[model samples]
Target chain A: MIDWSSFAYLAAAVLFILGIKGLGSAKTAGTGNVLAATGMLLAIVATLYLTRVVQLELILGGIVIGALIGSLLAKKIEMTAMPEMVALLNGFGGAASALVGISEYLSRQGETTGGMVSIAIVLSLLIGSLTFTGSLIAFGKLQGLLSSQPVTYPAQQVVNALILSAGLGLGVLLATSPFSELYLVLLLSVALLLGILAVLPIGGGDMPVVISLLNSYSGLAACATGFVLGNAGLVISGSLVGASGLILTKQMCEGMNRSLLNVLFSAFGKHVESKGADTANKTARSFTPEDAAIIFSNAETCVMVPGYGLAVAQAQHAAQELATVLEERGVKVSYAIHPVAGRMPGHMNVLLAEANVPYEQLVEMDDINPEFPETDVALVIGANDVVNPSARTDEDSPIYGMPLLDVDFARNVFVIKRSMNPGFAGVQNPLFFNENTMMIFGDAKNVLLELVTSIKES
Target chain B: MLDDPAVALTILVLALFVGVEIISKVPTLLHTPLMSGSNAISGITIVGALLAAGGEERNLAAWLGFVAIILATINVVGGFAVTHRMLAMFKGKEQR
Candidate 1:
């Protein structure tokens, strides 16, 4: 029966891999998710059936309670809050990994442990503890409970290095003395503290990278626990997730034109007052939604660039409506997505998808940049940094070399913003002052609604 | 199922390359779902949790395992559900 269940796990692992393969295309992504869920069901059932030798009630109770809470959370969270929700869940996954390591260690205390087993346990505990707290801090910053700015102190990196060294030293101690659970507890504390300090200096705008990195950590923690348990399914799935996360983290950094080290250490966007007053003196032509509608009506082709502000204002549906109206009026409409446009990679796509925006119309940054010059009107909504021209020209500017959406090259540009205040990086956008740019000052949703109305009327 | 640590290490390493190869091609359109889906899969640690909690010992191991099961279950369930919801909204023109 154990052998039979092992075969089931092997089959489950194959299905999990196929599930991720299904995500390769939008067409099959739904089926892939279902396949993965089926694999999960199989794995869980195999575990339960392998050991009917005892505590059924506790297992059932835990699943029921967990299912209720999990489903409720999934049902209740808004699409705009998805990033933070994912961050929070990642934290729990890491915690579970650490708990498994501890449980396994306590269960096997009477037996002599192998060197490999001891190393796996300590590594799992260390990675799990760090991931748990690191993800929590990410959630806090994303949810606005903590300051979104990079919180840095003198010699922050040096302190972080010393703490990590101390945690590794504790790992050595814990590994040598497996019976001393005290070493385990001390190592866990060091790791949790390390998670906080590691994430502390990362500004909120850089959360895409942090979240992706923590996502990787959670997976590696699971992998370490797999080694402790001698389970191939856990190891396989954990490595897949770890790889997926590392890839996404790299993607996010490339989107911002920064290295992983720079993202982690430099605390980019540390100051908010970097010549922001330049925007006040520079001429930004302000226009009303009605006036903006006239130019949009004349446009033959339009590109919509959305940002995190659009999510904050909950205007995706309105933006969709505006695009629909434009399409109805014989104007071709497509959305130009900046890779790091919203709070996370592909955030704009999620928000837009939620509003039933056609997936084909969401163009990638590299794919859409060349089309801007040929485009008639480009509408910038609730976005700033991704579309800024300074990333191309201003050498001294922090965002000097990052790729932009190139919305400035369009025949006409309409920027829907609340004020002339600088972006998250506190860099003034030359695109805002472009002769072709019209800054429409208002709340994003309100301005979008007004645009939809006036476009309908026109 | 191999009990050898070397076997597990080999599996982990091979899976890392396979994982990277499989996911490297995912288009940005579904990146959110890709992330959420992979996150849910990380809850595979639940197998170990079940083993520790399965015995009627009701000791420290059982309690910790019970707690671990619940937390991992949240990740597995919440992650998949959220991802499904997000994916459902991503309509292509053909679907509409």
Candidate 2:
């Protein structure tokens, strides 16, 4: 029976591998998710039927409570809040793994525990505590509960290193003397502090990397827990998650022209004086939704550029509505998505997807840049940094040399924004003052909705 | 089970490669779902949580185990649920 269950675990692991492999394409993504879920269920059932008789009530009670709350959260979370939700849930997972380590240590009170098990317990406590606190900090930053400014003390790097070293030293001590309960407590405390310190210096713009890295840590924590139990399945899945998180972290760092170390240490998005050309004498031309609508009605080709402002205004649905109205009037519309346009990687894609915007219509920056000159109108919605042309022309600009959408190359441009404020990077945008540009300043959702109505009436 | 550290290490290394290989091929468009999906897999630690909670004696360990079970369960249930919800919303050019 034990052998059979182990075989089932092996099969479940393969299913997980296949599932993730299938996620590489749009056509197979839905099936990939389902396959992974099925693997989870199978693994759970097999674990229940193992030789160790699980207490029926406790197991059922835990599952029921978890499922109820989990389902509620899944159903109620807005798409804009997905990053925060993922961070929060990852924290819970990390905490659970740490608790398992503690519980296992306590359970083996008088027994002569294996050296391997003792070492695994200590490592689990370190990584799990780190993941829990780090993920919580990431969640807070994403949710606007904590300041996006990098909060740091004097010699911050030194303090972080000391805390980390102390935690590892305690791990070594606990491994040598497994019965020393106080060592375990001290180790957990130090590791928790390490997590907070490690993440506190990361500013709002660097959240994607921090979140991805914490996700990797959570997987490592679980892998350590698997070591404590000598479970092959846990080790496999945990390592997989760890690697995937690292890859995503690397991708996010590259997209924003920030290195992993830079993201971890920098306090971005805080107040910074602009270094670009001063436009004190310049003024932006303003237009109403109705005027923008008339212009849109005459355009043959339109491109939508979405940014974090789009998410903040929850304008994805309205943007989609406007696109449909324009498409019906014989205007060709496509969306231009900058890799880092929103809060996270692929943020714009996810928002547009939530609005049922067809994936085929979403053109990435490189693919759409060449088409801008031929385009009749480019709609800039709640976006700034991605469309800012200063990145190409102004050498003194903070965001110079960063790749951007060539929206200014279009024959006509209309921007839906709140004011003449600079973007998150605090760089003034030259595109807004271009001769062909008109700012339809308002909440993105309201303006898009009005544009849809106005365009239809025209 | 405790005697096979080499086997466990081998599985860990192999899984790490498989993960990097498969995910590196995944397009940027599916990155969000990929993160959330891998998150659900991380809940595999729930197996250990189950054994600890269901063990004999109502000791401190058992109570802690109960809490562990709850958290891991939430990770598994919530991660998969949210991933599914998100994936269902991703439509192709013709579907919409």
Candidate 3:
């Protein structure tokens, strides 16, 4: 038998720990990435050393092909699609763990203490299946293949609750019974169905939380598979992933001014058709591009807030161009990024960064919120939820308690949207109707380009 | 002694806390790149599964190994493809 590669594995695990630590701080994130890559390299090499019956040709080929594909992907994908990318990666991890569990189960069917191994295998299978299906649904929504609006039926919450309970009940039975394989398959099917049903009713507004929660589930499945395989490293790394995913999910919940249970059960803001009607009825003043350009052209300082609509219109470059012109005319320009802006977390940052916006100019919600009142203009692009006044003024608003941009306090506010339609959360934005706010109803890219020209002509 | 489930559980719990705390503190600016980078790390599980499956001589083990290798490979390849497409969204455009 090959010697255990314990020392190398330990070193790799340490590297992972350090990498994760480094990732927390922006300044050291690059270093953390390097460390994690090194750890992975070390782990792979050590595993090779421990393999007595190695198929060198196959392994080498796989590595080369995987590396080439990975590098190409890294070079090409746009930042706006990062959330879908993340969801896809989570699915990949789940698939990997599940496959490993299944292989181990099949190999050791007769020899192992069947109870524990079977339990681990079943758990892995269930969680992995759920993660895979749930993540795909999230990807479809984020990519706009599926409707972003919540698909709700009467008694939807009750139906979901029953499904969840039944899935859990089946999981428990699979764990205890001797006829484990039959129950295992049942559990997997139930979990898959549960995943689809769980995410189906979730509105676009709650997708970030769904994605985070699914990520956690994938990690836990990996951890269980690690136990079954008797791999310490897998268990550790998997648990780390699972735990972090849960915490991130919680943070997302808090960011949306929601509780975890409420997100899961209440399906908050899933069908706010009535709320949309209320917002439409509110009389809001409008401004032509020319009239808005005059205010923008004269402003001493301006802060632009880009949202999902801006991305949908592919207007970041246009916005950047407008900012450049405004700056040349002596206006201080910056971008405010809410933590939960866009579909996924940090959605606006990725979009702005793509447009070559400087990292320093991308201010956080807290940093820029206080500065809005003193600013000359707060230009909102394809953004609604992050700027909604309901977070502060209306306690009954579904988005109440969520922190928001203080654009309402600005001397002048320009909102660029297709219409007065409610945002992802399906809530009316009172700011649109404010006297200081002017609606610029058009595609963000076209409107921004028009404003740039009008500013130049004036 | 090291195989004790309790020890495993403790390690799992501690690792998770540390990991979550670290990821949560990452600034908004780095969230995208970091997520993409870490995805590569997750892919390493493929290598582990490969070793476990191929090295064993038994029939069950060999087939298990084969399946593991195939699935893991798909996961790894597909993950990179999607990530690359996502990162491409950031090209061009310089701020003044």
Candidate 4:
């Protein structure tokens, strides 16, 4: 029977592998998700069968309650809030692992824990507690429950380091003497505090890195839990998550052209003020909806650039409608997507896809930059920092050295913004003051609707 | 199953390699789904949670185990469901 259960776990592991492989492409991603869910189901059933000493009623009730809440949240959550939802779920995973570690320790009150199990318990508590609190901070920032800006104070690094060291010291002490519940409690508290302080100084602009790193931490916690419980299924899945999340984090950091260490330590967007009072003095050429429509109607090639503003305004559908209308009129339209255009990595792509925009129309920054020069009109809809020319020329700009869309290279540029406000990075865009640039000030969805109507009427 | 730690560690190391290799070739557009999907996979801790919770005693261990089971289940269910919702939105040019 034990052999049979191991086989079931192994089969489930293979399914998980295939599911991940399927997620590599857009067409098969849905199937990949289903496959992974099936793998989860199999693992759960097998574990239940293997562990027969427990009450069936409790497990069923827990599953029913959890599934109800989870599915409801999944159904109700907007796509814009997907990253926050993911962060919260990652936190739950960490909390689960941490609890399992504590429960295991508590259950074995008198038995002398082996050296390996002791190490596993310490690691599980450390990583799990940190992941839980860190992910909560990430979720808070993403959902606007807390300030999105990096929260830093004097000696923040020193304070965080001291907390982390204290946690480690307690971990070592608990490992040497396994029955010290008080030491365990202290270690968990220090780890929890460390997690909060660790993420508090990370600015919202580097949220992708923070989220991914927390996701990785959750996996490491689970892997440690596996070691504590001697569970093969947990070990395999946990390590897979840990590695993939780290890789994803590295990829996002590279997309922003920043190192992981810098993203973790340096508080980005802190130097840039969010207020627009200083930039309001600069004159910006504003255009009415009709004027913007006329330019759009006459353009031979138009490139659309999207940013967080699009998400804020929920104008992705309108943007798609405008693109479709332009395409119907034989106007060539392509979308230029910045790597970090939205809150999370690939956020813009998800929004565009949700709007039913054809994937082929969305071009990456590197591929679209060279084409901008030939574009007749650069339609910047609710975007700022990624298109700002300061990244290229301004040495002291907060966004300096970050790659940007070359919208300024276009023959004519139309920027749809609510005001002359600086972007999240706190940098004023010089492209707005360029001779060819015209700002259409209004709500993104309203402006897009007007543009669509004008194009249709034309 | 608890006979040897080496076997579990071997599986851990191998899965890590496979995970990094598989995700290396994923396109930029699929990054979100991939993140969500792998996140769902990490919810496999649900199995561990169930085993912990179902054990014979109504002690502190059982209570903590119950909480673990619920949280892990949410991670699994929500992660997978949301990933599906997001993936369903990605359409090709022809499909659109």
Going through the candidates in order, the fraction of native interface contacts each one reproduces equals: 0.81, 0.79, 0.36, 0.80
The runs of at least 3 residues in candidate 3 whose Cα sits more than 4 Å from the true structure, single-residue gaps closed, are A1-4, A25-27, A52-76, A112-118, A153-180, A274-282, B57-67, B70-96
Name model 2 segments beyond 4 Å from true.
Answer: A110-114, A393-395, B2-4
lDDT of 1: 0.89
Clashes of each: 0, 0, 12, 1
Candidate 4 residue A222 Cα shift, in angstroms, is 1.4
Instruction: Note the residue pairs that clash in candidate 2.
Output: none
Better of 3 and 4 by TM-score: 4
True contacts kept of 3: 0.36
**What's every prediction's RMSD, in angstroms?**
1.6, 2.0, 3.4, 2.3
Looking at model 3, residue A194 earns an lDDT score of: 75
Q: Tens-digit lDDT track for model 2 on A178-283?
A: 4777887898899888888888888887888887888888888889998898878888888989998899899887767677887787667765676686777788
Among all windows of ten consecutive residues in candidate 2 chain B, which has the lowest summed lDDT? B1-10
- Residue B24, model 2: Cα distance from true site in angstroms: 1.7
Question: DockQ numbers for every candidate?
Answer: 0.79, 0.79, 0.39, 0.76
Worst 10 residues of 2 chain A by lDDT: A1-10
Model 4 chain B: worst 10 consecutive residues (lDDT sum): B1-10
Q: Candidate 3, residues A388-454: lDDT per residue as tens digits?
A: 8878878777777788988999999999989977777777788989889999899999999999999
Candidate 4 lDDT over B1-96, as tens digits, reads 744767767778888999888878777787787777787788787776777678887778877888888888889888899889898888888885
Model 2 interface CAPRI class: medium
